[model samples]
Target: MSEKDTTNTSIEENVITLQTAQEWAARWRENPLNTVKAHLIPRVDINELLAEKYVVDIRAYIGVDDQGVNKLMLVGVDAAGNDLINASNGDYIYDFTQPCPNTCDVDSPLYTLKP
Candidate 1:
């Protein structure tokens, strides 16, 4: 298979749509990446964030860790929980030296308080 074909085994695996982001946020909301805490999360790819292109290694609903984040051993499962499919980028970790949250855009409510 071509590299592109090998890159994505799932049609929406690398997609970061609004809904996918929401689910990702909820999954990591309790514990976001904190460099001081030595927590490492997935690096947020600019292209993926803007939906311009699907960058390899940056998956849906991933947070960037400025620290050496733990490597993930990804495995895909079917709705019925059948045979497991190892992710294309298995056993990988994404980290950055610095990362910050931006809530300035109306689309993003990183710091928005709800009533």
Candidate 2:
């Protein structure tokens, strides 16, 4: 499909925002399921979040509308936060693993990467 086709927001994305993703990222960070304990993956169902609600995974939400590099950065952090991707600050990091096919241009410092 063409890149323009991606602009069409899916029903799932309409229900979330960057803040929501960040909050979810925090929750994911606090949860024990993201890590290994007792030789098993902890139960994350207690989080009560859907696949789309996650900061990053097969689904992730960006801080901007449509597409842009800033979105990638935020989504990258969320991806990295979830340990699904690897990225750094001061650049537009790309992760082929992201389920979304959005790749936009971003040029600003406000788009901070998570340390």
Candidate 3:
């Protein structure tokens, strides 16, 4: 895929903001998986595809929509939080893996805060 297409697939926005705990709670109510635990991988073995070359970290947050499509945004943050990448449908599998796809680069526009 073209670089543009790859970016389009990874970038997303969180409708909820981190103003207060109440707001955070409201956001979570909309999407239960918005909690940190939801983004975490209990067993690294499940991530066999990552091998040793790639390091995975989890981050989570709540997302809200006017239409009531609240979502839990679980993202995989690299060693550096700036290098955030969205997990693939709660699954980390990729069609192919390399040093890191251009989409995975820290400077890619696809990078964003978990929530």
lDDT of each: 0.31, 0.30, 0.35
Instruction: Report the CA-based lDDT of candidate 3 relative to the real structure.
Output: 0.35
Error of 3 at 27 (Å): 8.4
Error of 1 at 90 (Å): 26
Q: How high a TM-score does candidate 3 get? A: 0.28
Q: What is the C-alpha lDDT profile of model 2 across 1-115, one tens digit per residue?
A: 1233323444333233435446544554554443211111112311212232333443333232233212222232244555322223221222211222232112323223223
Tell me the lDDT of candidate 1: 0.31
TM-score (C-alpha, index-matched) for candidate 2: 0.22
- Could you tell me the lDDT of residue 53 within candidate 3? 34
Q: Which candidate model has the greater TM-score, 1 or 3?
A: 3
lDDT of candidate 3 over 9-67, digit per residue (tens): 32122212234323544765766653232221223232432332344664454544344
Per-residue error (Å), model 2, residue 88: 24
- Tell me the deviation in Å of residue 39 in model 1: 12
Report the C-alpha lDDT of model 1 over 14-97, residue by residue, as the tens digit.
332344334434545556654222222233423222232222333322442224332222222334543233335342112221
Sliding window of 10 residues with minimal summed lDDT for model 1: 91-100
